[model samples]
Target: MSSSLSTVLLIARREYLERVRTKGFLIATLLIPAVMGALTWGSATLASRAKTTSHVAVVASDTVFAHDLKQQLGSSAQDAMQVDLVEPTTASRARLDEQLQDKHSTLAGYLWVTSPATAGALPHFTYKARSAGDISTKTALEDAISAVLLRERLSERGLSHAEIDQLTEKVTVDTSASGNTKAAFIAAYTMFFLMYMVIMLYAMNTARSIIEEKTSRVFEVMLATIKPEQMLAGKILGVGGVGLTQVGIWMGAAYAYSTFGIMASGGHVLIGLTQVLYFIAYFLFAFFLYSSIAAALGAMTNSEQELQQLNMFLVMPLAFCMVMVFAIIREPNSRLAEIVSLIPFCSPLLMNFRLSLTQVPAWQVGLSFVLMTLTIAVILWISARIYRVGILMYGKKPSLPEILRWLKYS
Candidate 1:
């Protein structure tokens, strides 16, 4: 490579290293995962501890099996819950209202399960809210009530315990599908998040760098030393290179973490080394396309105030890409999803979304990359042309037509 090109790369490497080495970066790198780990541990401990205590509120109805039912609930709840049985008490209408309103009530809803008249067939389930769970809460309640009713019925029919056991057989749901659903889910969603974050990060930096150079009049000096295209190339390459370096470092750290976890658990580990190549390829094309546009826009503006007006042109598309995150997850193989995934402007976002949800074909992936590269080449040429002369002009940002004319003239 030429010395100018080398200088650009060196400058980029320094910029990337400078950001990565900062205190903020170091704190964030360590803190986020640590906080997440703490939350996971804390939640598990709380859940394990919660099941041992049952809060029961008995209303104005008395029955033989109330304490027994409460006991069953406590036992079934697994942490060996101690039942806090609140006995029924009579009060004035206003006093009853006041008691119900009290927040300190140790009540998991009122148990009217043993109403003498209604306790024949199906057991009563009246609580403050809906049932707590699918298996342990809902099923447990039904099964307990059913056992009691079955015992009563068997006593009436003169049947034995062995006959009751024979009636309760086995039921199961065996399922199978020819798909890597979990991998698709991870890959496609990861792609969307990766694209969304990286694009926004690099694109904003590109614009800011352009604005800085333009405001400082460094572009003029830089222009004399090198072509605008080369300057644009170097800046994009440098910033983009820095971004890739950070990604590489993060990936390495992630892999190390994964390896450690796998060894601890005695499990196989595959850190997905191949995906890095695809990541770099797509990122470079996306950067060149986006950075050049931002640079050209930066050249046209003399001030930050002027740039703000032009910001919407880039911002809206990114917002659309973000909105599609759900759409991609919901229906990965939709026509709209497929079309968007193929489009050069939308590919980075949509492709990532599709990547996470489905097993994309090689042809589709290859074709999208080719089209994206072509689009970037065209955009870079246009941006370079406009930037060549736009850097020289001052005041009154050019209209689209005016910019086109300057690009032609430049």
Candidate 2:
């Protein structure tokens, strides 16, 4: 191997080892996944527990409707809602009001049902609750009331119980897809989000490392020993390696959990093997492209704060691509998706979205890869040119015109 290439590799190893050994890195590496798992489990547990029954009292001027409402509320049995009928007397009203106000009361709510003396009049129903904002309970009550009213109407029209039962019976349609729709969406969203996170994080790490070394005057000593190009190459390699390590950890954990039955059918929801391979390929190309840009921006700025101002330029494209993802999700095979997936800056992420939602022609995928690779190569050359000059000359950050001149002269 050439001495320059060997120097780059050695520096890369140093960078990787230095970062991997940090306490913050280790804690974050383990803690984030744990937190994510906890949140998922907690949410599911809460949803299941939320189905516990509520106690509600029913007051009615019409005893027949009151009895039917009680039966209707308990018909499902699954919800476990308890309903008791009370006459609409003053004592009953006062007692219920007191119970609602009492913090220790077990009553979830109360319903009031009344009918007019006029013939063929419909009953008026009102619900008052201790927790007035509980929309789910309110919705359930509304549906139950509707079902009871429908039954009464059907009976008045001379429909028999057997006919009414057949009419009201539920029928569910079970549809099958070639691939799981929900699984595809979840896998795509997770992978796309992870890709964005990895690229932005490591690329910024490259820029920050450059700024820190430049500020500390370590770049001077390093430059004397090795060329700027080698240093830049090493930084990208080392940080990119770290990102790959994090991804591998996550994927391995997922596989182990899936294998051991820790995850309940959720492992099957992830994208397939071909998409996984595409993800890795896109990640590498995307990382190199962004890191090179970040390196160049870092070279032009003396401090992290200045680098941030220039960082906005890099952020816009990624943000645009993220927004475009929603559109792509809505219409994965649309012309817009296809065009955006071919655009070099947006291809890495947008193409992944396309691949996840629907199958793309092999040629389009191949073309996207080609375009991204070429874009990375071109950007790497330009960034190296800027790094050769920008690191040595530092004062006020250069203006746009000055930066353009640096690109020309360098």
Candidate 3:
């Protein structure tokens, strides 16, 4: 027994160091933060660039209405959806055509609103464009025109500005059993993405490493010194440790950045440091549980083909739980969500997402932890049993029944 543990630990240390010291590991650790920063900066930069407006020639008898329409449709829209309403008379069109010819005309096209109408209503028009703008642009312009027309209509009637303001403002109702807070919302989302990402990273990595070892004949050499159970356990532990390291790096960077930035503008959500401990707890258990299954699948295949086919069972449950993440958060206490959460395979993800949005009963949380621990133990035994015999098995992969038989072979 002492020898067994020594072998497992030695194998684990070797595997961990081999992976951790790789060029890939260093590149990933650096690139992930850099890419995250780049994305955030890029999004902000794109958002900051003011949209240029297209100039439309407004040949209108109602000059006051045209001016109001132009004012309502601000110049900012031009950056994405440019619209310029110039008072281009027939004489001006001859010159405007030359400007249009350069193909660099800031003018997207002209909307000739000919007929007279009050503000806020759509005017009859002919618009010239190279191509149609996207729906969002169209929708924004529609909203502006609708707002202008609605106000004008309200004025034409006997309604005051205050009445229109009261009518136009949108209403939202907040309802929650717990206090509705940003922290609660953030907790739920954080739980979801963390589980999703960590599980997938370690699970797929385990499978890939197993396949790589099998293809390269490294497993045969490694198998001589270590038992299959030790090897399997060590591999899962090692890969999971690597994933945890990356996660730690990310969390540390985020916390450090947040600490400095809090002086600039404090964040709204507040999750305690203790919650991070729970995240780690759930993460470790989930990674080991899933990586064992992934490793078993990896042992069952000589190539990627059969490996992928078997992974669908694993992926499907995760995908389903993720799909209902919002539902889980909305009704964390619902009978169905609760039942789903108790399912060992789904609990880590489903419960975490719900935990954020709802205050789960302590009994339920304790019960879930107990139940999932047992389930993971059971799963590990099964996977280890399969690995013991299946690891050395070659040729065509066995059927599900055959695989079950291996576990039950005694």
Q: How well is each residue in 60-131 modelled by candidate 1, as lDDT tens digits?
A: 244445555555566653434344454445453234345446787544334444355654555455544222
Top TM-score: which candidate number?
2
Local accuracy of candidate 3 as per-residue lDDT tens digits, 1-410: 99899888887888899999999998877776566446445644664563534444444556766665666666323333434556747866666666656677655445556663665445675555434764444445556556767777887798998998788775666533344354356435755776787788779889888888888878799888877888988888788889888867755654443344321122432333444555666777778778888888888787888887888857887998878776676677998888887777887787666665656777777777888889778878888888777777888888889998898876
Residue 37 shift from truth in candidate 1, angstroms: 5.6
Q: Give residue 168's error in model 3 in angstroms.
A: 5.8
Of candidate 2, the 10-residue stretch with the lowest lDDT total is 261-270
Sort the candidates on TM-score, descending order: 2, 3, 1
Candidate 2 wrong stretches, greater than 4 Å: 46-52, 116-121, 175-187, 254-268, 271-276, 408-410
Q: Write the per-residue lDDT of candidate 2 for residues 336-374, one digit (tens) a residue.
A: 999988998888889987887887988998998899888
Give each model a TM-score: 0.73, 0.90, 0.78
**After superposition, candidate 1 runs with Cα above 4 Å error:** 10-72, 75-82, 85-191, 253-281
Best by lDDT: 2
Clashes of 2: 0
Cα-lDDT of candidate 2: 0.81
Worst lDDT run of 10 residues, candidate 1, spans 262-271
